[model samples]
Target: MSSNRRIGIIDIGSNSIRLVIYEINSLQAYRVIGEFKQSARLSQRINSDNTLSREDIQSIVAILKQFQRICTANQVEEIRAAATAAIRNAANSQQIISELQEYSGIRVELLSGEDEARIGFLGMIHSLDIPDGILIDIGGGSTEVSLFRQRKLVRSVSFPFGAVNTTRRFSADGDFSEEKLLSIRQMVREAIGGERWITEHPGLPMIGLGGTIRSLCKINQKKHKYSLPLTHNYPMSAEDMAELMSWLPSLPAEKRKKVDGLSKDRFDIIVPGLTILDTLFKESGCSHYVISGAGLRDGLFQEAYLTDNSAIGMSMPERSARNMLALHSCSPMAHLEQVASSALTLFDALQQTHGYDARARQCLHIAALLYRIGVSMTYYQFSKHSFYMIAHSRLDGLTHRETVLCAAIASYKAKSRVQQLYAQFKDVLLETDIDVIVKLGSLLQLAIAMDSSETQVLPVRSAAVTLDKELDITVQTQNDPSIEYKEIAALNKDFKKIWGLKLTLLDASSFSTN
Candidate 1:
């Protein structure tokens, strides 16, 4: 519940140990300040009898101690450590957990298969605006599948089909032959066959989480020379996935290291990971899938945040937007609120003239919250900075399309830079969408100009739209608002160009100020 403190989350899985440190602004407003991971691979060294080898225990202890030093150096205030399937399935898990606690001074909570699936689902639902579909998390020791409709977790199941285990069990020695690949596919099918919910929700997009899925996107992007470097919400087609799977199995671990985006250490396990993903795609009939960068650590953060904050069930977008603003801005929250309020007021009053609907209004609201974000970088050309930040930043609860629109609208506040920046994203946007962004940007410019002091205490009494497509804006003071009026007059030509509207300032001294 403290502000500006660092909280660390540790995830000990079958293949790796990872720690994520987050800087908190409030209970729900935080950002990842640091992260570290090491491939301990305790699952790979587990004896056939299901007991951890002594060498495995020593390696894990060393990794945990290294993680502790990082946490201590970063002044981590609290830590929540969890161990997943590898430790859960081990016969000596209890003794290992005890040794970890006694020697490392960190408590280890073991997560069940169902709990793991739920946590992955939690991370995905809050990170993506996905309302329905099958969520798949391919881990080292298990694969978790969860079904959600409407933003809530519905049903989840975990299976023993994992990348590390399958690799050691079936494809350890050489390239995957046709017969071996077929056996692996059959195994996955048998593990996931009877889930009627997967068939019931036909055509819903698949959202994938975990390191393997992200690595696949990275490799594909590198091969295709994709312009964007972002991995979150990166779209991949089933055909594209199949193409990569076909070629990847043939590349030995040494050759795989030569690939542009594939990490050297992940070479041995990637084949089995891709094989499982390919099978899942075929079984679910999902045409394409989106990658989620957040997973179990993010879920733990959100759960911990909600327990301390009053905003437990708020819509993810609004909460995420506010958190983003809080993390980036030193400006007064009141100012941002006023700008958003004024922009929405203008949007509602001009709906008949502009003919744009609620979605446009939502974009306007987001742009208002972020328009000045670039000021943190440099006051000069701040709107351009805001545009770049919104485009590049991982804003939760917004789709790729919405992120693009928001960035366009925010950039237009700079006025002179609008056309240049708008042209850069032409491929991703339609002409009509660009037109709407311009219209909304015009309204936002007017709203921002009205609060001349950058203070929420503007003496605006009321605003009215007349039938002749004119806006009569009334301010409470009679001491001429020369600056405000001039700002509106400066944009008059463009405003009329977009909305066919005339603007006039009404004298509030002739009537009640309130």
Candidate 2:
């Protein structure tokens, strides 16, 4: 509950209006606290003259009022609401915006197609560490495709064709035909082909946003019975998608509603959505797609928190790790920092001894920071609890394997053996990886013991590792420092077994002369 403030963001899209409330502790620390979504399909209700129908306007007002009430109940400090494609293209957009503002006491900013594409792209980049990839946001009224390389947004293009619009254009009466499907595919192909940049990068995977993509992912998860329920970075292959696309259209609308991942409300629009994805897969030559649950709502939240574009293209796994610690652990942050600092230094100095890469150092640092998080639950076998928490927690910018490795290391530092953890999580981690965790965990154990004095004011004079794998460490202290040395010496057996090295601790206090 220790956080800065709770704010609400409402994204009024052509297909749905969604409200997400975020509890923000800092620029790096924020999590979704409340969410409500209603499928409006406003774009399908627009009249031929390009004006929002009165029925759609009334429905929008009702949904906004409900959102306002929820925000009030949650005591949200501020609200950021924006309307996309449908509102932007409507001739009576200003009038409807004013009326909705008066009714709900919330101003709705209309976002242009380009703005929608950019914001959706921003949201995907900040949450997922895809160094280079294409972003696809299939909305109710429009589809925004953006390209990024090396974490920077390079190009963006918005096609004025989306699920709801395409559905209405081709098949609106619950009728299905191959001709209709082909026409939808043709439209998507033409629209995407106009943006030649999508094909410029051949093998980069595509990250997908919007309701349709999430629904498809959910269905896939239900079909596969995947262990993890998270959808943020769920990956789906083109072949599997092609199967879903081929099978979904054959079902009756009512049967589609009963499908595991397909929502009842979206049954009618799903065909077009999948068709668009199929064409995109062909045009981009990408075999897999990652589903991103965060979209414009998260973009609005980040924009408000950062107050600038600083969070746009940067990858902040370290920051995300710190924030995850801040949210879960009840231990003091200073203690965590001390352990992490010492762990990283020890890993760096003993690299030649351990022969692990930079990634191993990252695992050690994260483990040290989260080593005591399990104490929040109980002191008894806290390492086991820590493992469960890390495996389940939202630690971004790390792969599933890295997350398991970090959890395993934390378990080792908590007194569980690396072999035991490897046996438990063998499906996700390798035996060699387990060896690396044990080595890093041994180093972390020494670091934590060095700071067991609790003050962390003791200076480490120097640390050295010889080519023959002998590690000599000297610390400055006024006292004999016997307790610290004894604590570190306890791990000497494992250290020697794993790294083929002898660790010797020395105190400079006894040798110094004034």
Candidate 3:
């Protein structure tokens, strides 16, 4: 019944609904703790006019209450529920927010189109390592385009031509024609400052987001496989997507559902969605995309966490926070600070012997900080916690495969947890990475042992590594004789086992700052 540091976000988008719980890993990656999605289609009603019907309001209330129950049951400390186009443009948004907050404890913030676009990319830029590009997110009521140069978000524009809106304007009654399609393109061009706007940002990559792109990914995933349809990190080359674009406009509405790879759920509006994608691709002159299931919901949760006091909990142990986030929408920040410090200390002590370059050391640092995150469940049974949190956190700055290695090393917090963790990742996680995780775990264990006092654990501030036969560590100290040799005996033994060399420790009485 211990508490966690989970933060929950309820995203009321145009096409679907979602609630996500996430936490930071030892690698500073925010993984998804838990998530639930509902396809409410709130956008369908509000697109034609700036108003919400009684049914649309009621549908929103019911979903908000359900999400509230989830937040309460999980003991979520933070909740940031935001509405996009539908609610923002609604004639009666004030009344809606008042009703939701009163009944469900879910306060609603109506986001302007530009702010909506910026919030959606929070997870995309920080966790996934997206390069400079135009981030185009097509929603139910509007499309948001943000421009970035060398990774900084520079200029952003939003258009009223979202999926549901465009369908109403151009694909009424599920029919497609060259003229209707041209109008859709014309609307998009005007909203984004004409066709020449594309030439301004020459070669920046186009990082597509939102439901329209993900649905397209599902279709391409099926078409690429040919036999069985499966969804999970199915990367689509721009060339592959361009080939499929040619055929969609010509296909009739009812016949669209009959086509292979089209999901029954999206048959009606996929053409409009694809039209938006096609125009953007042609104009951007960029190919290659990183498809993600994470969008506004993830970004909203991240922004809420930073704004809330929950960020204070980020310094707790990974095990404690992982356990908390497991039960709630929370995790401890202790692991981030502790493991980060320990890894830096160990890296400084053994850089030469460990053969670590700057990037390799940084990787180890991330893995170390995120290691104990898996142990957050049952403290004694922490390896599983490491595996799930690291792999599934949906953190920014990491690929799905890169996350497996982060989880792998975290499993080593408990001996033999590696094999169990590796069972799922051997095909994806590299052998060298597995070795590094084990090495990092062992080194971390040594560092923790050295700081037996825990109080005023000065940490190995500076050290030199020598390899004659055994690894020799010459460490300097800044404090008086409060530290004891007995406190560090076990650390040397663990050092020997992991390195296959004896550990020799020399402590200097006093040191001068160079």
- lDDT (C-alpha, whole model) for all candidates: 0.80, 0.80, 0.65
Candidate 3 local lDDT, 61-81, one digit each (tens): 888888878877877777878
Best to worst by TM-score, what's the order? 1, 2, 3
- TM for every model, in the order presented, reads 0.92, 0.89, 0.68
Give the alpha carbon lDDT tens digit for every residue of 128-202 in model 1.
877788888998888888888898888888887678888888876636788888899999988877765665666
Quote the positional error of residue 259 for candidate 1 in Å: 2.7
Worst 10 residues of 1 by lDDT: 505-514
TM-score of 3: 0.68
Local error of candidate 3 at 238, Å? 2.2
Q: For model 2, what is the C-alpha lDDT against the true structure?
A: 0.80
